[model samples]
Target: MKRAAALTAAVATATVPLLALASPAMAQQPAKTAAVQTQVLDWLSLDALSGTALAQRVKELLGKGYVPSALNVTNATNPQYTSLWVKDTVGKVNVLQGLSATDLPKQIDQQVKSGFQPKLITGTGTGPSAVFAAVFEKTTQLAKSQLSMSKETFAKVNAEFTAAGYSIASLDVYGTVEKPLYAAVWVAGAATGAVQVTLGQTVEERGKELLAKTKQGLQPVLMAVEPGKLYTTVWSKGSATGLKEYLNLSKLTYTLKSAEMKALGYSPKILSAEDGVIASVWSKK
Candidate 1:
C-alpha cells in the first residue's frame, strides 16, 4: 500500500532550569472505567514542577477526573524547572498550577487583547535525564462488551510498528464523550540506528489503512469509529530535548492550533470529534 508522507522535524536543545511550584494537592478518588483515547489540541501551559512529583500527581488527577485526557513530558537533567504534563477535566479550568501567577497570565491576556493569532508558542525543553511521557488520561468506560474490531485494529497497528523498528512501551484505554478510544504509546529505538520508515502518518490515511487490514473486506462503517487520530512526541536522550506533533485531526489541525486553545487550555478533543476516531494529543513540556 502506498503510504502518506509523514512530517518530520528535530527539536531544539536547551538547558533545563528546575523550579518548583506548590499548589493544593488534589484529593484522590476511585478509579474510573477505562475507555478509548482521543487526540486534541488548543492547549498550552507553562507547568513548573518536578518530573517525579508530576508523575505521582498524574495518577491521582486521573482518579479524581481532572480531565488530563493525554499529555507528554520532556527529558531534563539537574533540572531547575521541570516541565510537567498535568491532567485536566472537561469545561473551562486552569490545569496549570502557578503558570497564571507569572507574566504568563498577562501573556495570555495580552494575546487576547492584542489579537495575536497564535502560530506556535513554546514548551519546556530538556536535559540528559529527561523523561518523555506519552500519557493518556483514563476516563470512565462506556461500552461494556469490548468491540471485536478494537482488538483487531490494535493488532494491525502493532504489526506495522514492529516492522518499523518501534515497539509498544505501553497501551491503555480512556473514556471520552459518549464512548472512548485506545492509546498505544511507543518507545523508540536508540540513536544508534533506526529504520528510516515514517514515524508519524496522517490520521486520515491511518484510518483507511486500518480499515483495509487483513484484506478481510472490512467495511469502514462497521468500524467507522468516531474521534480517532494519530499523535507522537520525539525526544533525544543525547540532547535532553524533544519535539511534539499532534496533527492529523479528524477536523482541521489548524483550528485546534490556536491562542484560544492556549488560554482555554486542552480538555481532550473527544467532544469535538464525537464518535469518530482520534489520537490523543501530545506535548513536549
Candidate 2:
C-alpha cells in the first residue's frame, strides 16, 4: 500500500537547517524573489526527462546557470504519494527520500542541513513503470532493508518443523504464518494429494503423538487427497476427530462430481447441507 504525504513539520525540519546557515547578510535578505522563482522554473524544466534521462538533464541544467535548491516529485496515482526530494547547493546535492505520510518538519530539517532551497514539487503516477521511473529519475542512490512480519511468536514452531521430518520449501517472513497461509513441504509417499494440514499449536506441540492418534482413528476412512492440487484447510475450533470426519465427508461429495461420474452420461442432483457447509453426495442415474 502507498504511504500518506509527509507531515508539514517534517518538511520544515529538513529545510530549516540549511536556510539558517546562510551568511548574516544573506539571512537578512527577503524571501525568494520573482526572478529567483523564474530561475527555479527554468531549472525545473528538467522534470520532463524521466529516469536516467532526467538525471542527465539535471546535470545539463546545472552546467548552465540553474542553482536548484530542492526538487520534490511524487506519484500522482498512488493514494499515498512516494516523494523524492533533492537539495542542491554549488556542486553538492543531497537527496531525501520520503513518503507523503512522513513528518514534514523532520524532512525540512534534513533538507536544510543538506543545502539547497526547496524548488520544484510535482506528482505523477499513471503507469506501473512510471512510479519507479519518477522516483529514480534524478540520481543514483538506493537503500534496501527487510521488514519482519507482526504476529504471534512462531519462531519455536519454525524450529520444530525443521526438527520434524518435513523439509522447508520456502518461508515468507513478511506475513502471518497461520492458517490460510501457504507453505510447501516435501513429504514421502502420500505427497500426491494437495492436502493442506492445519495444525493447532497444541497439536503441533504434541506432533507425532497427535499424528499417531489421528492415524489410528481415521485409518478406515482417510484417503489420499489429489497430489499437486491447491487446497485450503483451516484449523477449526473442535475435536480433531470431528475435523477429520468433516474432511472425509467433503472428499466423498467431491468424488461424486469427478470425471468418472460424468462419463456415465447421467446428471446427478447435488444439494448443500448445513448452509453449504457440507456438500451432499449423489450417484449418477
Candidate 3:
C-alpha cells in the first residue's frame, strides 16, 4: 500500500560553533559557480518495505546502477526495511542482510580487506541475537571509518577525529534501547564545521530540536531510533536554502508530503523509520 508524507520549512535563528579543521585534501576544491547544481533524478525511496520484497528490489536496483546509501529495519523482530537508493558510478557493491552480531564484524573485516568499504550498516535487536544489515561499495570515497562502538566510545572517537580533520559522512545506530552502538564513515577531505548531536530524545523533542537546529543552519545527517521510542540525531553544517525536513510523521502523511515535495522539485536525501514512524529530509533540486 502507498503512504502519505509531510513537509515543513524552517528559518535560521542561531548558530552552533564547530572546530575549524580541514585537511589539505579538503582545501583543493575548485570554486563554485552561481548556477544551481544539476538535480539528480535517478533515485528511489522506500518506506517500510517488507523484507521479502526488499530482497527482490535490491537485486533489481543493483543491476540498474543504483545503490543503497542509507538503510533501516523497523520492527526488528519482523523486519521491515526502509532505504534510500541513488544512482552511482558503476562499480562492485554488496549487501548483507540479517547477519548475526558475531558474524557481522568478521564479514565486515573480510569485505574491507577485499577493497570494499561498508557504506551503510543498520543493526536490529539487542545483545547476542542482534542482527546487522550492511551495504558495501568498492568505489567508496572514505578515508577512515569505524563501526560497532558504544555511545560513550563514539563520543570520544568523534571528538578525537573531529580534531584530526575528519568529518562524519554517515552514522548508524543499533543494539539495546538504552545503549545503542554507533557506526560512522569518516572522510578526511572535509571540515567538521558546526556539529550538533541530540541523544535519547523523544520523537517530539527531536522534532523540535531539528527545527531549531535547521533554523540555525545545521542539517541532520543521521537520525537513529531506539526500541524505547528515543531518537538520536546528528547535525552538521548546511545551507538553509533548498532544505526542508519532516520528522515523526505517519506513513500516510509521509507519502502525501513526499509527493507534494516532488512536485515542487525536491527529492528526499535522507529516509529512515522507527516503530512505524518516519523521518525524512528533502532538498530542492
Candidate 4:
C-alpha cells in the first residue's frame, strides 16, 4: 500500500563530543552456557514490508546468517512492518509471528524448554486481541519476563525489575490511538543505568528529547510510533562518540540522509517509520 504523503524536512542531526563510558565486558565474552552462541553482528535495516512478505524475507535472511534484532508494526491499521536484522552466526533461532496474547507465553515456554530464549518480542493490535511476533535464540533463559501489559503496569514493573538488578533485554510498545501496552524481557546481573522512556511525544518533542539525551551520552535503543500520531522511545546511557538522529523525514530525504550518514561511518541503531515519516538514530561503526 502507498504510504501517506511525505511530511516535513528532516530534523537536524545532533552531535556531541566523545564520552568515555565503560562498555560492558560481558557482551564481548564467549558464552559459557550450552545454549549460548556469541558472535559479532552486521546490521541491516528493512522497512515497508507486509506480514507475508516479511516472513519470506526473514527466512531468506536467516539462511544468509542474519537474525532479527528489532521488529515493529509501524502502521497497525494498514499493517506495515519495519525491522532491523543482524548478520550473525547465531545457531537455532526460532521466529514466531501472529500469536495471540494467550499463546505468546506458552510459545515462550515451549521455546525455553527447547533451549531457546526470547531475544526480541513485539506486540501489535490492542488488548486481548493483540498479536505478537518474537524471535528466540539458543541462549540461557531470562530471569524475568512479561508480555501484553498496560502502560501503567509496565512502568511499575520496569522500575521494580530494574531495582532488583535486572536490565531490560527486549522492550516493545503496541497500540496507537488507544492507551499503549508493553512487552519486555529482563535478565539478571545487570543494572538499568541512566534510562529514559518517552510516551506520547510529538515529532518535534521527540527530536528535542533525542538531542538532549545523546548529549548526555544516552542512545535510543527502541522507538515505536502510532501512525500519524505519537511516538514512544527508550534510551539508555551509552558511549556517545558519534551519536546522531534524523527525525520526521520524507522518504526522499531519508534516503539522502542515510547515504550521507553511511559515508560518514554511521549506522542505524534504531529505525522507525510511519505515515511517510522516517526517524532513525545512528552511531559510528
Q: Where does the lowest 10-residue lDDT sum fall in candidate 1?
A: 1-10
lDDT tens digits, residues 125-182, model 3? 7766665677777755554666678888888888888778777766767676766787
Residue-by-residue lDDT tens digits, candidate 2, 1-285: 332222111111112111101100111223231112121221121222223444544444334434333232322342221111223333333232222322333443454454432222222222231221111112222211111212233334434443454322222111122321212222212222222333322212333434654554421111111111111222212234322121212322333332223333322222111101122212334
Alpha carbon deviation, residue 166, candidate 1 (Å): 17
Ranking by TM-score: 3, 4, 1, 2
Q: Where is model 3 poorest over a 10-residue stretch in terms of lDDT? A: 18-27
**What is the lDDT, from 0 to 100, of the residue 61 in candidate 3?**
65
Model 4 C-alpha lDDT per residue in residues 28-130, reported as the tens digit of each score: 2221211212333355556667777777767666766666677765444456666776656545577776666788898878778877777777766775656
Model 4 spans with C-alpha error above 4 angstroms: 1-41, 76-78, 141-143, 249-256, 273-277
lDDT of 1 by residue, 22-133 (tens): 1110112221222223333222222333544554554443343333332322212321222222333342212221121133334334333433211111122212221222
Cα error, candidate 4, residue 25 (Å): 33
Could you list the CA RMSD of all candidates, in the order they appear?
20.9, 27.2, 12.9, 12.7
Predicted model with the maximum lDDT: 3
Q: lDDT of each model, Cα atoms only?
A: 0.28, 0.26, 0.65, 0.64
| Candidate 1: residue 214 Cα off by (Å) | 24
Report the error of model 4 at residue 252, Å: 5.2
Candidate order by decreasing lDDT: 3, 4, 1, 2
lDDT of 2: 0.26
lDDT of 1: 0.28
